[model samples]
Target chain A: MTKIYELMPDIQGEEMLILQNLCRDYSEEKLRNFATIYRTRRKDPLLILVLTLVGLAGFAGIHRILLNQIGMGILYFFTGGLCLIGTIVDAVNYQQLTLQFNRRLAMEVHQLLNREV
Target chain B: MWCLLNTFFACVLRTFSKKTFLSLPCKDFKSDDGMKSGIVRFFVHNFEAWFWLTSLILLAFMPPESTQTTFCVWHLLGFESCLGCGLGHSISSAFHGHWITSFKFHPLGLVAIAILTIRIVSVFNQNYTFERLNKKFTHDKNL
Candidate 1:
């Protein structure tokens, strides 16, 4: 299997390091499978940023829901993105939000792969 | 009960001061070890429920209709409309059993209340599947 970082060179910084650490114990086949699954499921921070910008028009919390924060998404939708203040904050921090969501995804995927392995 | 209340406030103080939820420095407290962990766990696990319940309580106290004294940043900034204009009024009306008016004000009020109730009640059980699903989509600061 490809080295974790080389296989997913696009993911860098903390998330990359995190995935690498989680996969350290994985067998080669398990790592390849994880890379494949994670690549498909990973959210694009850019997409979340675009969606947050969409809040200026309407549909305030779609990105939160995409990140699986259903309650927060609903709160944002009902509160008009917490009167748009929260939306602006979210827009500014979309990368962090994406990273947070992706980290959780990585953890879950890792656990599932472990089970399978 | 008193201890629980104190722990709740401790959690709140940490949240405001640190600008994070579930990132409490429980170990720094001088409280007894077992109780500290219990309180921290309680705060960490029930953070969302407390958040929604607090919001619900606050909204309940707000005047259903915006008064002259009410301040709206949207109106202040000269925006014609905003996504959450009538939501507060909607929530208040819904709480008072004014379903039609609540929906007319904001269609999401009842749905929000229902969701919050579900969330508040779900804290008692550890639904591992749902937890896993939720974890996949949400970030835990303490994690």
Candidate 2:
């Protein structure tokens, strides 16, 4: 079976280490299941950046909407990205957004998979 | 002399009404308290949907000036140029199918609509996820 590192080659920073340690107890099959679920749930930062660029082209808050930040998404839509300032800010901070979302997804998947069987 | 006397009477009547109005106690309406809480909660919960929905509906129905006049602090302040100056007009134009005009006013109008559409869709996604999670927990508890 593939190691966690092989499954999530792109995982980095604290998440990489945390996920590695958290999944250490799982069997090969359980780890595969976790990997499948996490992969589906996780969002790529690069994808967020791409969506933010789409915001620049026309839609200003698609990235925020994708991140499940409906409040901020609505704000950005109504305010024209707060006169494009907020959109620029989000463009710069998309990586952080991606990290936060992925982290939450990781935890949720972890909890779901670890439920007593 | 008759006109002068009539003017004097009118002045006295105005003054008397003013005095009585000023002397009246200011009453706070009790029902307003309940209404305020409900209004606040409405905004606090799922405010995004309400905001976008309101904007879309208003933009579709009301003329641009009506919505623009109230919310635009920058315009009210007499600023020659502000970041959001043309955005409302742009959105209004887009709603009217004036794509080129809308872009001319503010290029982000279409983007705003797209983002709003996505947000609306995600609300459904959010509810579905919540239900799925709830069911998962209930199933786990049953077992």
Candidate 3:
């Protein structure tokens, strides 16, 4: 499945083989079986920025939202007003959190690329 | 309600960022379906994305001028001052020829300004190998 950006002919030809190698034999049944499509998940830079903005505003939960970790994002949102504990915790572990979300998103995208359309 | 908003924003992220790992996508994704390999690359790229975002957050808190005294965003955020306090003042001192003041504020501030300035210039000159440099640092850190 061609990602939207690579649909153009010239660009398509240039990186075709490389892209083909990247997206391989995962069957449609396997993809649907996985529950959430692993490859479709993406970390929006804007969301990351907003999350970081919230982080700067001493709201670590914002990072959770960017990761689609809704439960935690809210916990932090209300709790954020109370202290810096969450923010500090986030700052320390942000790398892990961001990585986790990206992994989830990557799986989803892989599924999308598998779609028949 | 706020929780719903958070979910909405997360959806926005899902819609906009197509490939997730620094914008890479499987265009020619035919039968081979390298899910495992793609994940490895995703993790590798995530490190970078995290670093860049963290750096951005760090810079975002750099107190602004003119209203530096009156408008303190960090304070608004409910945190104490950062380690590199008075950095802006130190930078100003460096330009104003106040060496003592610059060092007094933050000894490393001027050096940071210098290195970053040099790198920015190198980027403009197209001599900057950002990926290679990051790899070197990543290696050094591991070592």
Candidate 4:
């Protein structure tokens, strides 16, 4: 009897592969949608502001935890939050965060865009 | 002291002054005007239209220095950093032994800069295709 995995081709599309051995389960269709929206729109550059606020508002350093800006996060956590000044600076320059994120995301989608037929 | 102050202010002023976009109003200018126009786009969305309007307003009012400072010009993006912090400082540090300073500024700073420099050289020093192709060659190994 043929399994469902047998019916559907693997990512390489021409081979027999197990579903369990694979990584994330995002389908091409979903990745395509993620790619399309990411490519065609402008994401709000306000995330920097948001992360900045989180960094300031918490002792655990919400900003670092979420954004993975690890070094600063650790610094803030240890120094009794001396980095608030830096966070304020980031809030003021929120546009840069937006632009940088957009550029990186665009690069990510560029890969997907190249992938989709 | 004065030279350092002058340099810092110069960078700040440059930051404010950089012309990030080129624009000509749809009413006043013809789109087909040639080469000096580096890149051009006719904004379709309402948001983009608003952005251009805002840009023009900024063009009219703000000095360049204040604007550049508002960028992610330095690492305090409210969180730690990303891979790109200390990028500006790393090259400057390499000439000096600002190793700890640069690493504190950004871990991937020098590496990112080196890779970027190499890539840029390759792009110009050779031929590269910025392409639109299929996903087979673009598979996600992590997925």
DockQ-best of 2 and 3: 2
Determine which window of 10 residues in candidate 2 chain A has minimal summed lDDT.
A83-92
lDDT of 1 by residue, B1-143 (tens): 12133335545644543323223222222334555554554554455455557667867765676444334467677977654657767888888878899999888878777866775675434323434544343333225
User: Compared with the true structure, what per-residue lDDT tens digits does model 1 show for residues A17-112?
Assistant: 557656765778888899999999999988999999887665789998998879878788767775665566566557556866786788789779
User: B-chain TM-score, every candidate?
Assistant: 0.58, 0.58, 0.38, 0.32
Stretches of model 1 off by over 4 angstroms after superposition: A1-3, A9-18, A68-82, A92-100, A111-117, B1-54, B66-73, B77-83, B96-100, B116-143
lDDT of 3 by residue, B33-128 (tens): 466545544434343233323333343444333234323335565657542234545555666666887788666556645543543343323212
- The per-model DockQ list reads 0.28, 0.07, 0.03, 0.06
In model 4, what is the error at residue B138, expressed in angstroms? 20
lDDT of 4 at B51: 29
Instruction: Rank candidates, TM-score, best first.
Output: 1, 2, 4, 3
Interface RMSD of 2: 20.2
Compared with the true structure, what per-residue lDDT tens digits does model 2 show for residues B47-81?
34544565566556545444323333344567665
Which is the winner by DockQ between candidate 3 and candidate 4?
Answer: 4
Share of true Cα-Cα contacts across chains kept by each model: 0.33, 0.14, 0.00, 0.00
Q: Enumerate residue pairs that collide in model 4.
A: A115-B134, A115-B135, B15-B68, B16-B64, B16-B65, B16-B67, B16-B68, B17-B64, B17-B65
lDDT of 1: 0.66
- Cα lDDT of model 2 by residue, A13-107, tens digit: 54565466456567898899988999888888888998887765547778888888876777666665655545554564565457557756876
